[model samples]
Target: MSDLPILIAGGGIGGLATAIGLAQKGVASLVLEKASRLGEIGAGIQLGPNAFHAFDTLGVGDAARAMAVYIDSLRLMDALSGEEITRIPLDEGFRTRFGNPYAVVHRGDLHGVFLKACEAHPLVSLRTASEVLDYDQDGETVTATLASGERLRGRGLIGADGLWSNIRKRVVGDGAPRVSGHTTYRSVIPVEDMPEDLRWNAATLWAGPKCHIVHYPLSGWKLFNLVVTYHNDAPEPVAGMPVTHDEVRQGFEHVSPVARQVIERGQDWKLWVLCDRDPVMDWTDGRVALLGDAAHPMLQYFAQGACMAMEDAVCLSAELAGAGDDLEPALRRYAARRRLRTARVQLQSREIGQHIYHPAGAHAALRNAIMQAKSPEDWYDAVDWLYGSTGLEGAVSREARTLGPE
Candidate 1:
């Protein structure tokens, strides 16, 4: 590898994970974050066994596992009936089969694990408030322009700037992202404040018509993360907007009484309008490439958005590890390896949002019936391609078999 570090835009989970992955391979990278400090702002995220595998590969598995809440199963309940349609066992047998445990964790806790590792690694350089503005690359190197008008040169650039990436418009020439027409309200509260009967430890989803709610214990069961999503035409996409509890209650007024009770318990809710781009074949241009949400943004239904981004970090680092003088070829190889798999995830996430999360009338009934008919093992088999991982190479093969041709 050259002495010059690879320049990474956006210091979110994907960017930090990329730095960690490269440092593990004896490579150097400079991560530029727009924020003044490195921190994650979100409720909760579920990590499958594949995410654990990626974390282990990056040598931070122990720290991540220590902060996570291992759940026994994933239960999908009908909002109207308050009955579990079916549950996927993520118990000892499942862990033994997948080689890792399923965990639900606060997003900040997970980001903190990667951020600490990146800060400690000798090969990683992290800079905050140095937002990437644009880039120009020659045959030898890429120069990234920062918001402060400072120019930094590096061997290559990785655009992990996230959903509304500035680099994507310049690289792939893709226009604005497509809005999902779904608005999300999320809140986290102390577990002690929650009702005794509602203090469930497992990852649970309450599915209803045109709306759904997901809640689970986080911070080692000290806090609970609650997210409620419904169909509403948000004219524009925004995040961290304050929403009144009454507003959220109105959205779920028609839902089951149990779901209503949960919604009523939450205070100080924050809102986000979901947006994602359609996957593209071109994520690389010369020595510049896109990673994570910049490369393939998807809906949150699959719970694989962050997981896939972390996987991309691992795959990209592996490709660039021993490529020596040729960095472009390594980038091309990374893009080729990820394009189809991410496209499948992107499409499947949309399908899940439309069919499983928010169906109406007859479609809703049929969705419930189909879910109730499947056995726990059958549900596991359906997502075998997602939670199973042997490494980057194994991931490509499994994704190929599961998603078929591009």
Candidate 2:
């Protein structure tokens, strides 16, 4: 094994998972995070079976499962009538078919699981308050300059730095991400605080014209995570901005009474101006590569942003593990393997936001009808390509026999 480390920028889920994946392969990594401590600021995340497969590969499946709520089904309802349009059952048969169960978890809890695993690994070195300001890479190695005026050398570099990544500027040269003309308000409250009638233990989505609301139980059903999104143009893109409960209610005034009832239950709502970049052909330059949002930022409509990033970590480590002394080829292979899949997700997410989640008048009716016609098995088949397995050797896929989505 190489004595040098694979330096990673950003200590979020993607960066830490990359370090853990590398460590499992007897490779070392150094993760630099800008925050004083490692944590996630979001409320909840819905992880499909694919994420659990990645967790199993990273050796943290049990820990992650212990903190998550395994949902019974995913229900999509009409926000106006609050009627169930369709549901994808995640029951025993569904779990058997997918090889893993669907789960919803608090983002912070999931982050902690990855963080602890990385910290316990001897090959992984985590540094907080150490941001990557810039980098210079040659044929053999890459040097990362930190915000503290310190420089670190590594065999290669992975820019897991997220959407507004500094490394993305130097590598892809893409400017700021484009705003989606959508604003999302999110909050978490005690499950007991919600109306007794509204307390359901499944992942449910209420879809209306130009807006939608998604909520599910998290933290072992002790809390409920609610997110409401609508088409509202902000002056500029921002995240985690505080907004009043009234502001959130006003956005959904036209929604059904049931929807309003749920939206009004939360006190504090944080606003986020959603943004993403167009898919690009290159996510790698020489020995430095981009991962997660830095490579392909997508809207939350698909709920695969973090899932894809975790997949990238697994794939990157798998390719690099067998590349011998040549790191660039491995990085190129990783990018090639992920480019099409991530691009599909990026484009599909945008399309789903418009066609499926935000349709109007006749289009909305047609969407609901079409979804209603599909059987639960059909829904499972629709995502078979996504929730399958990666089947990589000497990595998470080492023990698997099939390759699934990215």
Candidate 3:
């Protein structure tokens, strides 16, 4: 079989970035998205140093920077008293230290930047409303079948379809992800409508036992993106699409009035059940491999979900560069290099959730005291291994990895 293009499932950030990265290396890839149009929910995300590296490497850094706001400071506050406990300034020095600025952007805006980059490349093609059913490999050629019965051949497959990935089920035999007994409610409110005090060029996090709240400005300060996560004992999942403001308020009533005020102002709130998988050693099955949430689903506590996915795209393309003559070695290398790192991130994020959200009496008191006494920079230092990663460049030594498989 002649060299075929890579088939990528899912059209979110990871899938699109993978397409752009592959195209930049003169490799061909096709993106299959189940949705008729690519759009994200009304929410915001924090993009740290590692994600910036992936954006720059993929050639979308300029566009993303233009649309995103650089968060110059992050403040942690007591949810009950509404009083600041720590303030971390993120200046040029911080950027120099981290190698990239910590920025925040609307989820849709970030996805749009990646989509534009993919659209410009000749080697990248996108097919919307096309759902992939399964894939089978024959030596060098991998064939993927869509639900519509259309078949497409490719050299490899990257399942970037996210947490409910159909491809992941086929590869790992469908085990349910662990739910942490928590649910998140998210919404975007008009900045002008919010209290003027809430408008800041920083991410503000209010941490409490069994609940926490994160708020930051978006759309160039035109809107405030708010997210509230709380523990729940209910056995059933929260229902209804586009959760109403009433639902958001009810979920956070146990929180401070400041938290209540933020939720009350949200008119277009949405809810999601937070779930994640324990990292697996096996993310590859022959020519088909997993990427992003499909490969290593993580809790939102660390805010590295999208960032890790973007890093995966960059590393996968780099590993497969110029391997058109042979496919097995390159695909295996990608899987091996990514599995450990992603698994660690998944585990760390889960641990952070338990520590940050479910702290016991002493643990909670100690956490509060540390936040007040320690420099916020110290907190960032603790996560340097995560935020400072340069993907494959940091994961594997370039000079050594060039020799191919060990």
Clashes of each: 0, 2, 0
Q: Give the per-residue lDDT digits (tens) of candidate 3, residues 186-305.
A: 878889887776777888888777778888999898888988877775353442257666666655665678755776676666787788888787778888889999999898877888
Q: Answer with 2 or 3, whichever has the higher TM-score.
A: 2
Model 2: residues with Cα > 4 Å off, grouped in runs: 391-406
How displaced is residue 336 in candidate 1, in Å?
A: 0.6
Candidate 1 colliding pairs, count: 0
| TM-score top scorer | 1
Across residues 1-406, which tens digit of lDDT does each residue of candidate 1 receive?
3889999999999999999999998989999999999998888999999999999988999999999999878888888778777777888888887789999999999999999999899999999999998999887799999999999999999999998887787899889888888899999989986767778778888888878999899998999999999888777888889989888875687777876788878879999999989889879989999999999999899999889989999899999998765899999989988888889889999899888888878897898898888876777778777788533853456557777521
lDDT of each: 0.87, 0.87, 0.80
List RMSD in Å for every model shown.
1.7, 3.3, 3.8
TM-scores across all candidates? 0.97, 0.95, 0.93
Q: What is residue 176's positional error in candidate 3, in angstroms?
A: 2.4
At residue 177, give the lDDT of candidate 2.
95
